[model samples]
Target: MEPGARAVPATLHTLRKNIDSIPQGVQSVVEQFSVPRQQIISDLNNVSHSIGFTIHSLLKEQVYSVLEAIQGRAQDLQNSLHHLQILHKTVRTLTHFQDELGLALRDRKESTVSLLDSPHCTSCARALGKAQSLEPGADYSRVPSVEQVLKTLSGLPKANFPDLIDQGNSTFNSMPDLAVAKMAQVVQDLKDEVNKVSKKVQSIADSFPVSDYTQPLNDALMQAENKSRPYLQEVKHYEKYRWIVGIVLCSVVLLVVACNLLGLSLGACGLAMREDPSDYESRGEAGAKFLLVGVGFSFLFSWLLILLVFATFLVGGNVQTLVCKNWANQEIYKFIDTPGNLPPSTNLTQLLNLKRTLNLTSAYQECKKGAGLWDVLQLRDAYDLEDHLHLSQYTRDFQKRLDNFNLHFEEIHFLDGAGRRDLETFRQSGIDQLDYPMFQAEMQNPVVRTSLEDLARDLEGLRKIQRNITIAGRLANESQALWKIQNATVLTQEALVVKLNESVQFLSAMAPHLQLLLKQTMAEIALIETMLPVQAQRLLRHEIGCFTRKELGYFSQYLNWVRRTLTEDVASCQPLATALDNGRVILCDRIAEPWLYCLRGDLSLPHPPRYSSQAIGRGLRHLQDSDSR
Candidate 1:
């Protein structure tokens, strides 16, 4: 029906040519028959165009649009047809990689740290997941059966399974196993610095112009501490069905095979009862070959239809994995694969005696593996609360407070240093009234100017901190920690905290000298205290930045790893998406496309072009002849 509608415009164009081509004899004969009409041919041409336009517009809206939509859907289904195969390849790769890792971890568990149990393993898993575009727990439900994957493997050019396993092994071996020790060392270092800083701050407090400055400092602390703090916000962790993924893959193979072959098993049992397989071995190899051939020929004729069935499978599978399609980002992420079971931690201490197991966290269903980066990039929200913690916004404000305090504390000492030199110079000038060169040199000195400029530059560094900071950073709740560090907010906050802490101990040691300056700079001290605690929620916000960076230490290590292994990692992950894509190209060159869907939505054999099939047949014969030689 739609084809006929499309034909209207072409028919009208043909009619126009026909009217123009009429010979003079035919025109005069037609003129006598239509003598009453003026320019009959032109009138007929106009009518034909009008009919063509109406048919064209009607079909454009009612027919072509609907067909286009249907075609689009068919294209999507065709592309996604090989989704199972992709999952299959992934299952094989991950299974191989996981087994190797698990074994290597077991070997190490007896000696030192178990890679299987460490948070660092979680970090590695996170990176591997992103690099491969698979969210372990989130994507488990989409994993195909071991059988399906094995089928795909049979057709694949052998994957670099050894290389993948070696990479996994190397990655784990390269990982720093003594994370606890490192954390302990970091904590100890922070403690030493804190203690040293506290003593200096306390000494300054001792002779801190008690009557004039001490009261103002206390008032500032009080004001800052009294400020209200925001509630601590945490990410809502999704239930990870990761552990079931491997189990589901194995179970699929079993269930599918079991359901299909139960009758075969029963028939085999009946045959065994009649005669054991020992009877067949009693005969010669020739007798056995004869028996196998008879069975093959019988099954061949019985299931001759399966050839076309398998051909359809080939066509369908190849279409789904078309090389031009972006299945890596699209189809790979579409379905949720079945989850896998997580093995019990080798490092975890199990109680020998217990009435019931103690559950420490509601995240029992959570997979041990880390989430991937794909989820973070795919969210629709500009700044979803789910993506970040409350501490993100609070960190920078805390750093600002620290900066203000440091500036005031250091400024007082700096001014005192400059003042002492100035006072001594004045006394010397009085003693040596004839020293004109010394006085002239003093006029040329830029001591105060340099000091003021340094202060401004340091203050400007603090100013630039917030300007570079962004909202996206503070919220890397469940993100790929390695990638999340790129956020300006995270970097800026970290920089500010480190900078503020750098001069803390040195500035604190100037208590005795600061006594004179304290009275002079009391307002500077007062202003810092008042602003620091109030804007930063007193101490909590600053501590949040400190705590966050401690974890960032782990993220940094992972980023270093990715940099080193990026090429290898890309090579490792590329095979699964590309494995089956070549199926179509190979088929188009070697196999014949015999069937197609007709316009009427029914299956039909395609009409061959003139001598096309004969040429293809000849190509196949010539290829066979060459192979035989």
Candidate 2:
């Protein structure tokens, strides 16, 4: 039992080793499902990020820039077109003035007045200068169709793609955290089970049949032994006298036997030698005398031998029946345990200085009945071995170690309200609403339908119709001024058209992919919303929880088995009782029974020596008679 107590801690250590592996088991189970789900969530986040990137590309690089560029260029075209209209009107009016100048000059003297001095030519020059000085205004009336296009583009709604992508990524990332929390719960529950099992084992260990009474009882027995020294010495002294009396009693019979055997030998030798019976020195005469002496000795010691045998029989029989029998059956302990049966100094209770009444008979009977020595010795009030087992300490340490297991994890997010809102906003962003075909058609169109340079050339042709030198010169100058304005407007509008065309081509190419990306991103969001939680739940319940329960089951079984074995099997004291029975056999059957049989034989054998002596006397006389012949 002491060895078993020592082994308990090591056994608990072994249990601890098994418990420590639970986290690894949980992780293995968690990984079976979590890894794949995590990968899917990651893929969804990538899809969301891609959608944001595509949206940004379409809005910033394709749609917004293109529309803004188109609006700016359309405004330029309107201004240029309006300026050309004003220039044409101004040029037409100048042409009319020039024509009137030519008509008036023809009617007037050819060299009578200077060309610069002519009122019509002077008026035309002033009008042309004013037309050239005219700053272009943004006239929507000149290009009503383009103004409508700009308004439509400007009215398009904006979407927050970056925020949507972040929301989706955060939502997917939080799944791993939830899974870890579930795993932590598994570990903690398993630890709780481990602690419970440890406590159970400790409880069983405490229940082991151990007591502290043995020590005090042993001390009492030792004191009794010390007190018994003088009595044991007195018995040893009496045993020496007993050996002397036994030898003296055996010698009386041996003396008679020696005389008988010698007489017989002498008588036989005399007969063989044919000795004369009358001769005093003859062997026959000596044989007769020796036989008579043997008879005399036998007659003299018969009653003494009877008395010794009778005494030995009475003493041995009484001791065997009273002492050995009682000792064998453990009944002698009763006699010794009676009050005043022994000296007070030899009393077990007095020696132990204990308040509880001590009973030697009861203690011995209890021991013979296979009660634990501690309980038989009556040490319950003196000490509690149960308190010394320290089972709670083992369980406490086990529980403390159990606390070390936990599932490792990083932060993750499930979709929150903000994320859902962002996703909805992304879904509803009106990318599909924009008319790609219309934008494409508009970009494909030139900034102006009619060439301003052609208009300027048409104005230059007006000089041919004018015969007056001043009128033709004024028309040529006006045409050159209109040509300069057209050149600048055309260059700026052409650059805007080139940028707009690139943007339109990009948007046109991305349109189908953008729609597909949006659909795919939405599908991924739905998958995360519907599938991730279920997978996590299954992992926590089926895999991790099952594994935890299995480990706990094994742990409980071990503790219960230990408890059962200790309580039922280890508690039996049958072996001790068997040993005590063997001791009884050794004392009563082997030792006392043989001594009683020997006493019986001594009583039955006394007359044989007397009879043998008489027969020897008869033999001796017959030998004398034969020798005389």
Candidate 3:
């Protein structure tokens, strides 16, 4: 009977019509496929080009039909559910309004009764009595009658009396509890109708088997899995390939070693023959020819061994290229491009061409740009490279840059307890707050000044040593030339020996200067250490001075270790050179091994000596004296 209830059936009818329309649209789409497959076959026969077009059209139509059917069904279900929900909400609102109306009526009635029983009403009645008692001229008869008084007391206007009564009666008749109970009955009826419609919808939905649709999704997933599995296996295979390449590289290295050893033995034999060719002549001419043949065979075998080693490297390069290509094709390359494996790009080429047009020294400038003060500091540990060659140049450049930036070394602050303790007690620290004035004074000190002067002098010495090494290299080449001439009987053995001795003399002269430079460097280090605090020193101990007691101890130990290592290295080099001087060729080679190997193997090894713990402890004890004072 309510307006909201009246709209529910019409809404339900519309929803049902929409639901039914979905199946009708689907049936129309399905009926369209009635054009036989034979038609497609006949079209292909008439024009082969039309076959693709026909198949595409047919497949598209089927896919669109399925999509439309699913969409329509989903929309219908949504509409039906929404309609039902709205109906339920409307009923609930009406029930709530009815309850509010009943409460308002009860409240109004109770207020009226309370007002009539109040003292204010009694006072008003007393005033009416006083008006009635007035003299005849006062017109006491003008007072309202009891019926009018009762009407006023009722708090309702005369014209509204009937309407109020009707309203109260209607409200009583439509009690919220009763309305709610009636609404519940109507809701049950509506639910029964909805259930019937739901059954019909369910029956329609059941007509389409889910398995038919799920099968296609499963098939797609299976195909994707099949495609990815081979890539995964390739990754595993590439890992094995890497190991194989490593093994091959190791074998090549061994072969190179073997070849070098063989070559050295053959060269030694050649040298012996040249030294005593007359001794060989004392034997029969046939024996001399046999010796020559043996020497030739040795040279041939050495050449073949070298060629084999070279081939191994070429093969290794090829394998590396293949592996790199395979890596690029893998899924991993989608995330990261391996270094040296990038594809060529026109944009990159264009950029490079533009740089060239600008006259840019691209590679050199890039390297210079990357080189910083830290890089120079790192070079100090690189013994394999001639670090001293660039040391002063890099230092001056860095200092100039720092000056341009208006930057100077600030005092180092330690954040730990040990640092605070060391500072408070005047203990020797690693990177203590720099006393700028003291540093300036020390730099001006004759000893310190002389050390720096000597450093410059030492650098010149190093340059001289470098020049000698260059001369030695040239002489070695000349010696080789002279040896070959002697082998050809163009030069005598004595002349060859004289040239070799000259080269050796150059190397020998260069050695002492290098040793002197090393000694001067050690002396400078000592001066720096002496300038530092007596007890656990800073400065020269670590490249970066120790700031805390713990850091100081670490630096001290590191410096000591470096000092000992350098001493041992220099000491070891002595015997190596001596053995070379003694003509023990094997010993000379052995001596070169330690120096070369150490340089190559531990390229980044810290060269600075470390401070010992005992030194730090002693420093701490000395600082305690200061605290006591």
Candidate 4:
């Protein structure tokens, strides 16, 4: 261990300590080399002898070891460099993050200060200043102080840092609550004012003169109340009137029942008298007269009872008529005259116009004389007269009469050979000229024209039929006369046959005695026929031959019978014509009777009876008895 050698050992010792300080796995490899220095030199000599290695190998080994050491040192330095690079990158990222956070904080602080100091913010601050200026004693608690409001608003941004905008909205929401509280306070104040007003009103009401209105109000209320009870009582009175009418009806019925009973008893007595006529005679003239008188009385009484009923009916009818007339004059007529309080001239004009326009001759005539004004006005009011005034009752009645007269005239014209022409004239003149305006205005209305036109057509048809009947009657009379002549001819033929039979029997009885005479008469007839000149004889023979042929021969016998039958027929036919003439006269009389009666208004036929004064008197007496009963 001289100086150099000692340095080597000291280097080796430091090397060994360095190798030992290496990681465990690397220390193990180093420990293997640390066995013995002598063994290490020997093994190196053996390797050198066995391979015959030179100094170059030694130098190569040394160079390889040095390269390995250098490579290891390079790897350790690279690892340390990588760790330092990672550390530098982490420090740079942390510095950059710190700078970004500081910039954001500074920007937020600057924005807060700038926004709070803006002009809009100043306006809000001024509002707060005004609130703060409020008097301390004048409900300042209700009106927020301006300084306190600004402080509260300003604190919002700091207190709710993360939700400053949201807190601003919250402050706005709080204003609604404040408004509600203000409204409530105002409402309470209004209620207090209303209460004060009510008290003042009550005091004024107490000061008013109550006595002045009290008596009049009480009187008015009492009058209204009193009228209510009377109105109810009037209704009750109307109901009582119905009962009173019923009682009167019952009394009348009772009287009628008594009258009927008396009549029946009287009728029974009359029947007994008639059955005992012989007994009445045996009882002497007095009894017979008494029975007769009783029978007469019964008849008179029955007639009287019937008359009484008739009189009662007449009285009732008259009473109903009067009542209807009164009602018409009051309710109907008065209303028509003053319809909705219209002018009287308007009503009168309407009435006259309706009468004229409806073609009601009777009503029109009455209107002309101002007599039908009431009736026409009544109808005008009842119906929508100005709009639909056709065929009111009076007008309808007049039209009915005019229609009947027209029908009768039409029948007469047709019977007199003017049917088609008259019908054409009526259609063209009368029907066509009818007030069609009334129909056009109300075409859909069923009652407007359909019924009237149908009735007119039907009446015209009836007139045509009546005319046809008249022609049929004349034809029927001619036919009947012809039939009678034919019948008479047949009867006369029968009589002629009987007479011819009688003549034949008489001739046959004389046949035996008159045979030679008959032959001589025949020879004479033949010579007389030849004795005349040719033309003369021929003429004579012709005349005789016709006479004999017609009168005697078998053919002549037929001729004679026909001639006799014709003679008898002519004679009978003559009488039939007379009878037919008489029948025609009688038929004419029958037809004319009704027509004449109708014309004269003489209702005295079987259809209309005439009562004697005695009968009338009896009837009156019976009515008196019935009424008394």
Candidate 5:
């Protein structure tokens, strides 16, 4: 071969040694921008995928969280709205009830006069009068009527209606005749009002749904659950189906073991059959015949060996001998003795010659009297010992370090020594923190050139200056504009309230009709008074025509009923009003929460739980301090 040329190394040191050195300025001119350019390209290549991937995952996780919050809040809002609507309907029904009651009251004058003339009303009034005079719980021989019902329901003590103050007739002297008569009309009015209210309640219930709000709430919660469930299910189902797959795999392993055992048995049988030369063909026979002979012989011998090994000594047998020739049959045999023929001839010839009642058979047959697998048995006993020891660490270097640490720990077992070691450990750990993942990044995150708190004085000055600058001044102008708008809105609300008061006054001014023939009833005057109208003052002076105890009692009962109805209506509507108010407050608070949190720099939405990595040295120090305590 011809002599070959040698190539020098192209590495940095080799290159510098071989090539001439350039001056500093020339070098900078040659590679300054080029090296940075290459570095930029390399950084872009290395960081682009990581940055994009990280951002994508972060965005997806944040989006899911946002969606979950939205769905959950939507459900809350839906429930609030639904309940508000239901309450609104209830209020509307109550208003309708009030309207119907007003109509009933308007038409009751004629009905009142007729009911006052009824016999039942007179009887009830007389009973009530009698009751007022008699001891409590005393029985009177009178049938019950509407007056007794009212007297029973009134819950008042020793009060009498005007009907009981009869002046013209002696027969009606024991009764509050006028009041009892008027009560029948009141009863009819009550029934009509209850019926109308019932129908309204039923219609409202039918129009609104029982499950509409509940179903939406459930769906919203379910949607939140589903945000994480779909992907999580892929992982969760792995545990579920894993059990099934494990079962299948276990079955396959068992089958393989069984097949292996069977193959071993077949091979052993073939070897066993070869011990019998008579079963084989002649040496001059064809190769096919040998194979046929071998297979046939294997099957025959395997069956025979199995029969003897398993069936003969089935009591305590080791049939493993059938598979491996090296193993011996280990079966226990039970034997029963029989007299010899020689002994029979000498002393028990009669017994030997006599017919036996039971003919005893082989030990295996006598024990079971059944047909099954064959086997035999042989036994041996032995024992062995074992040592169970494992290395604490796999690699020599790690094990050496572990052992050294153990020795170091032993030497520093005392409190003072241990504390000194702890400090040293902490010093080492502090150095280790420099290599901790994201340590520098985490440190950089909480640091700033100028924190908001530190820049407070500067911020004030900037604010004032920004008020004059064109760009930042817009924000100041907008803020002022918003304040102006809010003030205007307050003024507008006050104006609206003033207009409402004026409207009420206008309505009150138009209350009395300019007709002399038509006189307004006290009830009409009373009804209008609740409207907060100024004209209601006329009710005090209205001619009710010679007011008596009976008339006064009648007015009290009516007013009591009206007062009770109004009380119940107001009571029932309070929760609805409260709920609506709370909903409004919650909406405002929720709207303001982010803004307030942003201004304070304290917003922290809930994310999935994770293990937070603390500084190694800090954690160690904390643990040590806690242990010392």
Candidate 6:
């Protein structure tokens, strides 16, 4: 994280404080150092009365090159670690997914009984054949029960429900198989890459004189894994029995269906073939025996069947009513999470090895609300996660190594002692000691006593005046002599003014520095000699600070991200809740509803129509009496 903005200079300030902010701070320092370095270089040439001098920053070319190489190596290490981290996390995800996939596959295979194994299918096939044998004309309607059955069969959906489910399972299994194959290759490659990156990181860590800063981060990762191991193991243990329970329940339902189907098939077949009611060898007699046998079996097993269904209904219904519905409304958490409401062992905080209680209501609500894991779990109650991100113990050795590096400047002497003394003496000379404003005022006046151009003009005028020929000629000669003198005086005065201007400008430029240059020069020399090592030490420490801060900030961000994703996204209990709801639907809707509907149909089936000989005799006697009348 960034240092507070007010603590740092405005130039170093960042709008957001995080791992990335470190670079801005370093850039600010680099810019600050560059200004002074450039100033010193430019001003070195301007040192008065000095020659054959060179000046540069204490940071030499070789040192910069070495720093650059170190930085590159560190970056390489960071990149390797980043790749390794991604691969490791991916491997963990794939491993968890693979386990879940295998469990699902096993459960599907176990819970799904073959269509041949279901007696309902066999009985239905037999009944369908019998129905087909009946005449497709008026005879079909003679048996009203059969007519209704045919109508119902015709109305049923064309698709086989079991076959559709099997097809769906096949489609589902095929994709996972291919995906798993590709994922296997991908996981192997990722594992190999993780190893390679790990070795590379180790090599880089070894190259550093510091203790490895990555150790703490690695330990943190391991700690998280260790913490989750127990929970995963518990799930695995529970999964072992899940399919067994499903298969047992399915078998119970199938046994009952088989008995019912056998009885119905025998009774229906016998009734169709029966003709003579009094014949002992008649199929009707055999059918009546079968019906009684079926009744006896039903008497023996029906209670057991009812008991199973009732048990399931009681447990499942209550769970749906009391637990699942309340869970949906988020009310169950409050009830269960009350202190001492449930046993201590049932508390998730106890399960997770936390010292303090994490309110179930709060945890569930936060997860549902999509809060970050660190906030949801309140892991800070156990340990300070941010504290582990700091790399002071690791980076101190690196700082020491940098400090030990020889960064002393070679003794720089722009001038010998005598030369420096002479320069000082020149600075003290009366040249710049003059009253400059007075000199400037005095020098403003023209050097000539009169205007030369005006004198020349006057001479020309005198020459032009009309007079005796000899006197005019004499005046012209005198005017020419005066003009020549004026021109020479103008040139001489202009040359003198140019030289004086140069001298005055130089004096004015030097005047302010003249008072303090010697003391400053001496002080600068002394400071360079005395403070170069100390400044270098401070620079190393500052660079170390920046490096560690950036690294630690990055680690802290990573940890926070991992925590957030683990609790809020990856390890959500929503999936478990959803699975429970799905199981309820499968038990109640898919299994129980169909079974109960079949039972209703069986109970509603009509008994065969009875015909008595006595009724036939009475009808015959009545007909005889009618014929006699």
* Clash numbers, per candidate: 18, 4, 15, 4, 26, 0
Give one digit per residue, the lDDT tens place, for model 1 in 1-629.
22222333333333323323223222232223222122322332243233233323432332333333323322322222233234334434444444443343233222222221234332233222222221111112232233432343233222332343344334323212322222344334433433343333233223212123113323433443333111101111111232354355335434434432442344344334434443322232233333333344334432433454466656644554452132333432222111222235421112111012212111111111221111211222322322222223323432333233310111111123333333223222221122323322332332112222232233233333333232122212123232232232223332432332232222223323333432333344344335432432333234434444643333234334432232133112122123223333333322222222321245322221132335435644543453344
What's the best-to-worst order under lDDT? Answer: 2, 6, 4, 3, 1, 5
lDDT, each prediction: 0.30, 0.46, 0.32, 0.33, 0.29, 0.40
Question: Candidate 4: which stretches are off by over 4 Å?
Answer: 1-160, 163-169, 190-629
lDDT of 3 by residue, 265-360 (tens): 544454456435543223323333343444444444445445644564455444334433333343322322333434545233232222232212
Model 4 per-residue lDDT tens digits across residues 208-237: 222232234335435544554555466566
In model 2, the worst 10-residue window by lDDT is 136-145
Please give each candidate's TM-score.
Answer: 0.15, 0.39, 0.17, 0.18, 0.14, 0.35
RMSD (Å) of each candidate, 1 decimal = 57.6, 20.0, 64.0, 84.0, 56.3, 52.0
**Strongest candidate by lDDT:** 2
Global fold similarity of model 3 (TM-score): 0.17
* Residue 541 miss distance in model 6 (angstroms): 2.5
Query: What would you estimate as the lDDT of candidate 4?
Result: 0.33
lDDT of 1: 0.30
- Candidate 5 regions with alpha-carbon error over 4 angstroms: 1-170, 173-180, 195-215, 218-255, 267-274, 277-629
**Which should have the higher lDDT, number 3 or number 4?**
4
Q: Which 10-residue window in model 3 sums to the lowest lDDT?
A: 406-415
- Model 4 misses residue 559 by how many Å? 99
Q: What C-alpha lDDT does candidate 3 achieve relative to the native structure?
A: 0.32
Question: Distance (Å) between predicted and true CA of 373, model 3?
Answer: 61
